[model samples]
Target chain A: MIGTEIPVLAVLCGDRRPPDMDAVEAAAEIRYTDEKGLPDALRGADALFVYDFLSTAVPGAWHAADRIRWVHIASAGVDPVMFPELRESDVVLTNSRGVFDDSIAEYVLGVVIAFAKDLPRSLELQRQRRWQHRESERVAGRRALVVGTGPIGRAIARLLRAAGLDVSGMGRRARGEDPDFGTVHASADLVRVAAGFDYVIAVAPLTDETKGMFDAAAFAAMKPSARFVNVGRGELVVTDELVTALRAGEIAGAALDVFDTEPLPVDHPLWTLDNVVISPHMSGDFVGWRNTLVEVFADNFARWRDGRPLRNVVDKQLGYVPSGH
Target chain B: MIGTEIPVLAVLCGDRRPPDMDAVEAAAEIRYTDEKGLPDALRGADALFVYDFLSTAVPGAWHAADRIRWVHIASAGVDPVMFPELRESDVVLTNSRGVFDDSIAEYVLGVVIAFAKDLPRSLELQRQRRWQHRESERVAGRRALVVGTGPIGRAIARLLRAAGLDVSGMGRRARGEDPDFGTVHASADLVRVAAGFDYVIAVAPLTDETKGMFDAAAFAAMKPSARFVNVGRGELVVTDELVTALRAGEIAGAALDVFDTEPLPVDHPLWTLDNVVISPHMSGDFVGWRNTLVEVFADNFARWRDGRPLRNVVDKQLGYVPSGH
Candidate 1:
């Protein structure tokens, strides 16, 4: 039975609010607040929308979400929102899944091409006004291992395949015939099979089993000619092991978009590595992305208000939207 | 009828000779010469191979080629050998065509992705150890106009289209349908249709009629956001006009692998432009490319020896291998 009183919606925002907040205002009373004001803002809210996906205030203010029946984050990765209390609660969780797929896929392809063509070396030479000519590798016929079978990883696999790469995928389960990836290898066999590929890409969701998955052993297993790319969560890789691998030439190069710490401190050793390409976690953020994220939230909000099944509802035990549903 | 006499082959080389000159030694009497030795070497030669494609000695030595029957260049472009003396002569001309097609196409796709993702900026920021994150444009759905429709250009068109770009082509004539390009626009209509594209790529062969085609007017006609890429001969574009276009913001950027002058004088203004990416004319010179060139010439030599029709025989009148031939 639905309650007769008007439902309350709370939005946790940072300096910037979600675009077009008016779309949800008519359906529910909205309470907007910063990280510090989250507790008071969530006191009577029945549904919480995490507009500031980077904030860690939610876990601390979980006690105030007394009336909350659902929680949604404006990002594909829901790691920050999967706190112990929330996972133990009856509240449903959903994430912005489809929004970043194509954008991230494009980013991955860009970096892959960059590595094969040695674009970074060209740029470095450009800075010195040098006209040095070097032979570049062809991406066509090269092998790539995509370390996740989720939408983002699937998108990356498809784009890479389209760009003439022989691509395979690594997922929770092994399968022989996937539409995007013909062979899906189990994540457990990553180290054993990693040597066969020229490019290894990680787009896995962050979970207890996945944290620090790319350690020294995995790096040592990769061929010296291989390139490692991570557009997934930073904690998914062991940063020190990667740095050591790059220093020792265990891998030819790496294109990292995420790190354990944001803004990857200026003093970090990875900054000085010639073969490493670092991006500030902006792989999926294309122009007008913020507006699109807001629209996704509003559409989901309408469904919640009408008591309909939400899109992209996460499976708490699995820590992500499962393959089937 | 095949010639009964042993054919004399003159090889115009610089510092390096063809990798396996022994392969053709059994078929002909080989005379290896540098630019200065070309005239003496060409005397009484039945065929001349321009191993130093960069050398301009062929025209000067034309007076000594009393018995020369065929001239083959070790490069796709036959600009150096297309002089009045040779063009008016009965000597057959062939190029190392198919060898560089895929490599050059890969380079074109690399620059396109670099421009779309602003990888150059990312590298520059990396140099400064800055962690600035900027939203990048997606290459998918972006319109690209390939300026040439030969093998190299067709390869680029197909690869770019596969990578999710909407690709079209510019050729001598317009057609509603082409296997690689859905619509082939007339080269004469470049300015009129140039504005519709996000990228304008030049892979047209260097010929009298096509020289300096991408002038100020052509640059001005392009969208301000468009990027220009040239993997063709340098003289296909007017260097000064291109500099003006880039300086005045008529176009967003340029990736030039070929320039009007080899070595691109260190003082050239193009080296200073933040938006320009200058590579030293090595787009198609992949590893072992010289060996492949030798192999192609050897195969063509065998066909010549057997009195059979040869592959990649250029139509001197039109300056390239015609599409249907």
Candidate 2:
């Protein structure tokens, strides 16, 4: 525990940071800054709250983070903060895990239904005022393979099953029986398992083992009629292979929210693909999410002040919580 | 029942009709025709199976339908066959009920999620090759008012509820406690209830009381952020009023699958409206729906042969069956 002489907490924020963090303010002395001002702000701070998880500010400012003992990221994925130095350091790591579970589940379900109902074609016709009746596919009783056993993946599995899709989950291994997903398969089965499901959703975290996990082989193994959705890290998939597969009609379609390069360039082929659906990574951000982030940080701040074990502590070496540990 | 001699059934077909309606063919001596040859095809028919419900040929050949005892429409909406002469005739009108229920429900849930997830905006951004992050709304626990209590409406309600929407159904009357919808409200309460919900969906059959039900006054009652979805007959809503409501932002957006005049016309203002989604009156045409319609007709045909009361017998005056009578 740090000296209780009003412990200093450095908060990293963007322009649209949460308006009020009263619980955090009441518990600690705070300093906030964007990337430009981060190094100076990190001076004398015992704790760090990464409110801007997407910012490249962390690495640049890490050398000056001498007093930091506990680093909390307001994001489910700890990839941005798991640097080599931090992983080997004494600083504890925590993340916002449960926050985005339900919101992202809604996103996956939306994309699934959108594809099943031929909504893209409908919207295209709507643009031309063309009243062309077309037959759509049914979603119920269809098979779905969600390749992540985390809370977000489980939430999606539960909701998809409730909405009548036959859902199966895959994780690092078949880690005992899960109430939501019967038995999660190892990542090795992903390529082989691709053909059986109509919808293959990717929500796995980013790591050496998972990076570019869905490549040419996996796409080739999928049924020609199947669709893919990626709400996880952009690096989890090989964009070139996916593009080749889509162009060659190896798979029916793809709904890609996260991309290998965010702000996917104007010249990117994905922008013009007829069968691809793209969204700038906003699936987990529901209305008032900023406020929720603040609440999560504040709660953790209260725990830190009381010298209690922090919530959502990450198993730094594994790259994520064994379960948002 | 008619004479034991194989009953002559005139099957109305369009250019793209369901292939091999073997069930109907095996049960009855079927004669087929498009609009041009309908009159000659109906010359000796004991029963008329209006498979091409969209064809205007029914009205044109109604005067020559002297021997027609029963006119079975392969559709849920009987409006196409409910001509002035047919309404006054002794022909038994039966529809393909129960087939479209779940399919249309899937469509509704799709659009609902699309709106909540701001998927339209996402697609628009993708088209512009812009990566802009935006927060979306949660579909779970959001209230929805479904303005129909028929099978199609009930199916939508059930699916929406499963997808986590707080759903309520409104029927022509509160007939009884429905297992799926519980105590449904009267259609008269639609306007009053509209203000309380985030989504207002219309799936009612076309009838005198329902025609122009959703007009200026009804639109005014809806929340500013509310979205309207119409999967029912086009005439059930006043298109002009809907357009006006959309322009003024009386409601957030609309997903109109049916229109009073379809192929909604190239010069229609709705085509240019950014907040509207339109599909050509096909919310429930699943991949094998045509085959299912044939199976429904074949099943009803077998019952008719045994001299049993036909299922989905529409109440001539009311325009629809009372719970598939």
Candidate 3:
């Protein structure tokens, strides 16, 4: 029954559409729709491709996804599409996980270096045409705690260690002798273990247990000279606590690519803080990333059509693509 | 001759005096003076310590150095003290060279990553409270041409390679299968070979042969997307040509730590350019760098007192501590 009839793939797109989708188009009948048209498009589709990974319309229109046997999102995190109805169903869920690993890893390393070298201050001084000299901190030999042990977090750990940083990881369970991260501390011990790192990078997925993991206590555990970087989901941190921590000098700086509310309001205090470096949630996006995202989904679609084991299959219970998959 | 009469050490200071000089003060009869008092202080001194490495008054006071046997500068480059008399005389010249290697290497990597990740732009947008998402480039697998084969350049090569860049070297002579840089291109071929790299980092010392090495021709030879970084002396670049190249878009961007002039005038055109990142000539100066510089000089002073070979003796004619020393 897998290939007996051509499967319909409902492609959910926002203002921007995925590029290089010829292969996906050829393999399945593609139904393109915006959020408003998603329900109609998904009425009898065998699969749903959430090209607009940022949209939260899926949960509201879940009733129309009755025939959706498989769902693929063009993003690493499944938070946007992990609706309760879908989680309870037998439908398979996959993501574009490995595609963003190295790219985000490079971004993490870049921000870490930026904070260490005081590059933001240099650029600001450059803008003022000032020639003031200041001593900068060295990135090498600094301790960094990567708060996720997934492929993306592992990639970051590898790159940071390569740049001479002592790297450790935070995961579901404490373990030793990990490949990329020498020691993996349990996520439950985040508050306790966070004190030892000069840089605490949050790359954990958003789940019931992980949401608001980086609160006032976590920031308090960090050294006043420590920096925080978040390339993970925004809700993984408490925004108010981070703001207070930064304002009171509990932490030295922060480089945030994601926010609880993106395009973070114009009057938001984080914009005015000299220590906070904010980007519009594009850490993993390299040139031609859209093409890569489409390719990942297309390759996965081919596998599904052939009744083969899908890549990056998310364990609904874990809320992510579990380890050793 | 060896620690027999307790050598008279003249320490040349500017507004800031060297800190933690207790050892040097105890080891010899120390005479501290500013530029104006330098000539009188050097009249009977057996050795001179150029604590203020930026001063050009050494040549003006060279006549008073009749009893001087050695001069140690607190800088990697000996450009300020490479006067004709010093180069022609039997006087030994030593510089603080190795101390800056890893620190400057980290700075070079930081700027490279800053450019690759568009961090400067992110900071600018953050200032304006704009959340625009842009695709950035990857640093890994990118080709880099380190235009100096000295310790600093070698350190940069090693660190960049660790960060996954394919690094080559530029030196006085071309060679293959080098240790840090796999391939070394001759400085003479910079204009021709500059086209092959994404980044060209100039860490060469200021010498007659290397002066103005990165001129208009070199800029024209590079890709329009290439970025130039200078952690070397300012005279190594033709400033006017660099300004023209930057304005005409011959090259994409430049991160200049050194310039033809210190405290680059208030209304310089380079400061107005959006593509240029200007920093004071302090890339190698890290936290506690002054202490390290002083320690280097103290250790060299001990070797001089013992009549043993100095650690960083500069080849006066070559203008730098040459490789294999």
Give me the candidate number with maximum DockQ. 3
Clashes of 2: 0
lDDT of 3 at B49: 97
Which runs of model 1 end up more than 4 angstroms from their true locations? A1-4
Residue A242, model 1, lDDT: 98
Error of 1 at B246 (Å): 1.1
DockQ, prediction 2: 0.82
User: Taking the tens digit of each residue's C-alpha lDDT, what string does model 3 give over B1-325?
Assistant: 2957888999999678899899888889999999999999999899999999989899999999989989999999999999899899999999998989998898899889888889889999999889899999988999999999999999999999999999999999999999999999999999989999999999999999999999999999999999999999889999999999998999999999998889899898988898888889878888999999999998988888889899888999999998888
- Answer with 2 or 3, whichever has the higher TM-score: 3
In TM-score terms, candidate 1 sits at 0.98
Tell me candidate 2's TM-score on chain B: 0.95
Per-candidate TM equals 0.98, 0.97, 0.99
Q: Which predicted model would earn the best TM-score?
A: 3
Cα error, candidate 3, residue A87 (Å):
0.5
Q: For model 2, how big is the iRMS in angstroms? A: 0.9
lDDT of 2 by residue, A40-108 (tens): 888888999999888767877899987888999989988888788889999999888899999999999
Q: Give the 10-residue window scoring lowest on summed lDDT in candidate 1 chain B.
A: B14-23
DockQ of each two-chain model: 0.77, 0.82, 0.83
Residues B199-288, candidate 1: write the lDDT tens digits. 999999998878999999999999999999999989999999999999999999999999989989989999999999988898888778
Candidate 3 pairs with clashing backbones: none
Which 10-residue span in candidate 2 chain A carries the lowest summed lDDT? A14-23
